[model samples]
Target: MADLSTDIALDDERIVRALEEDIIFGRLAPGARLTEDSLLSRFPVTRHFVRQALVQLEQMGIVVRERNKGATVRSLDPEEVQQIYAVRELVQRQAALLIPLPAPQALVDQLLAIHKEHGEHIESGYLRGVHETNDRFHLTLFGACGNKYLVQTIELYMRYSLPVRANSMADRAALDISHSQHRLMIEMLQGRDNWVLAQLCVDHLQPSKRRYIDLVGH
Candidate 1:
């Protein structure tokens, strides 16, 4: 029974991740209804699993559930986008600033490897791969801050702004810019200028924030 329960839990998690990617990649547009019937037809899971997945998404800030409305992809207004991005910028910059100058060779090598995978995904036009690796690269970079709480805050804001950030994932030019920026970040890590690295981290977040605000109109 324990093995069976574990398998069910893993299956539920898989559903949650797939739905998350759908929302993040714009396949599931903001405000689209996530009906249980629809989800059941899509995944070979029970209604209970669908409900659990939706609850997890809600906790992640990727979905909103209302009494009569069921679940919908969470949409942020311009003001909300601005606020979330502001926090994200602050936390991410602070995390970068905390990293030891001339980052350890191990850290540099790790980031390089992730960056390489990110570039390959972009070249192959694999949107899922690109999104996953891009996230992995950023999280790994920020994790070096050596402050778990700060890194957790940075990650939280990243989750909150997913709808706003999704636009960039589908834009070719934006992806290229991100790819270049990741390479620059890796190079910056090998240097001793913490301020420059910190500023770069803040600057890296602007395009998506600006683009989202413009699209939604303040």
Candidate 2:
């Protein structure tokens, strides 16, 4: 497991992102405690920055802070998982419908580039890289919907889903399934099949949702 000592001289955003990466990559397991003293020691930052980072992480649904406990990586129960994925499915379906098909050559090229990088990361077994690149691919694709609020909501929901994804992110089979869907999404965009693309978008969210719920006894 990678430790804080390795993260030297990082700013607040970097700290938050690094912590989030650790959680998603399983370096910081769900329910892992996050203390100000521990975080301050890891990065050259003040308590304010550490607190701010924790607060941001909480808002992102990656961490939970209690009255007695400072902060811990967040975990979702079966019901919460189902509710979130249901909303995600709806938002993603709408986003897919909004994407203009044949998907502007520029958008297609951009998605292709992201997809290629995602594949490379998966091939190298770089879990953090895979997570990051996969996020980029989806953000870029969803952003094409041209609805700022809609895109923002989707991004928020995605963050909320990250911990759930962590339950299966390490599995090679899961990664393959995810990347395959990504490729199909790109192909659907190219073909201008909005309904199929929308259905694929909804279906794509199922595996992770099911995997997480199964782990928690859904």
Candidate 3:
């Protein structure tokens, strides 16, 4: 393969990250073809590394590979979205149930820090920062789930879902409302009531998904 970069600036991880980000942000739409040659000739990575990243995404249920049809990103429908969240909540609820409550106050503290930072971003009208910071909040909470696979799965889901969230939260007023609701979710987790925490998680998803369905539906 001809070197795609003069200085070999494109590494395997960098290429994968770039592709993943594009997919996450919906620049690469679902069902869009991803050819190895086009990418390899364009990027400096070997076919092996590209395949590896694609396989990882497949495991996370975001990318699909068909024998003859080729590989493309998954197109998630409303029912599929509901199923993903329902299963996620089930697993996370159990994870929360088992995560010794007091032992992870540090997670709550991290969410607090993220919340404070997000508030500033909100005021500045940089809505994307709020979305990223919100990821940090949930990342902290769920990262300590003690279930490595579950945590990883959730992160992958979040990456792909972010564009959906960012689009809906484009309104500053709605972003502010969302921030307040997320803050309440963090507080709810402090109680050690796994059930309530699970419900809070489900409820938190409602506002954004509702906006997406409404906005995108029309």
Candidate 4:
């Protein structure tokens, strides 16, 4: 029974991750309905597992469940986008400021490796790989702040901004800019200027926020 339970839990987690990747890579656009019947047909999981996955996604701010409307990919309005991004800027900048100057060689090396992978994904037009590696890069960079709570907050806001950031993920120019910025961030990590690093981190978020606002007509 314990083994069965573990298998079920792992199955549920797989469903959740698959759905999350769909949403992240734009296969599931904002406001696209996530009907039970469709999900049931798509994954080999039971209905209970599907429901559990939806609940988890809702909790993650990636999906919305309405009273009579069912679950759909989250769609953030311009104001909500602005507000969420404002919070993102604050927490991200704070996290950057907290990192020790002349960051540990280990952290810099890890970031450089991830940055290289990110650039390759961008060049290859692998949207999913691009998104995942880009996220890994930022999270790893902020993780060096040595404050778990701050990193957690930054991560939460990053998730919340997904809808706003989605469109840019597929834009070639945006991807190139992001790739270049990652290189700059790695270079800055080897220096002793925390403020410059902090500012760079903050600036990194602007293009997406501005692009989202403009596209949504605010």
Ten contiguous residues with the weakest lDDT in model 1: 1-10
Clashes of each: 0, 0, 0, 0
Clashing pairs in 4: none
TM-score of 1: 0.95
Positional deviation of residue 167's Cα in model 3 after best superposition, in angstroms: 5.4
Q: How well is each residue in 85-186 modelled by candidate 2, as lDDT tens digits? A: 989999999999999988888998999999999999989999888988988999899999999999999999999999888877789999999999999999
Kindly report which residue stretches of model 2 are placed more than 4 angstroms away from their true locations once superposed. Answer: 1-10
Candidate 2: deviation at residue 28, Å? 1.6
Q: Write the per-residue lDDT of candidate 4 for residues 1-218, one digit (tens) a residue.
A: 36988887898899988988888778988889999999999998889989988999998899999988899999988899889988998888888888898988999889989988888888888888898898899999999999999999988998899887787987899889988998998898899898999899989999998898888774
Model 4 steric clash total: 0
lDDT by candidate, in order shown:
0.91, 0.89, 0.68, 0.89
Give per-model CA RMSD. Answer: 1.4, 4.8, 4.9, 1.6
What TM-score does candidate 3 get on C-alpha atoms? Answer: 0.69
Q: How do all models score by TM-score? A: 0.95, 0.90, 0.69, 0.94
- Cα error of candidate 2 at position 157, Å: 0.2
lDDT of 4: 0.89
List model 3 lDDT by residue over 75-145, tens digit each: 65666666666666666566556555554577777788899999998888665576678778776777666
Ranking by TM-score: 1, 4, 2, 3
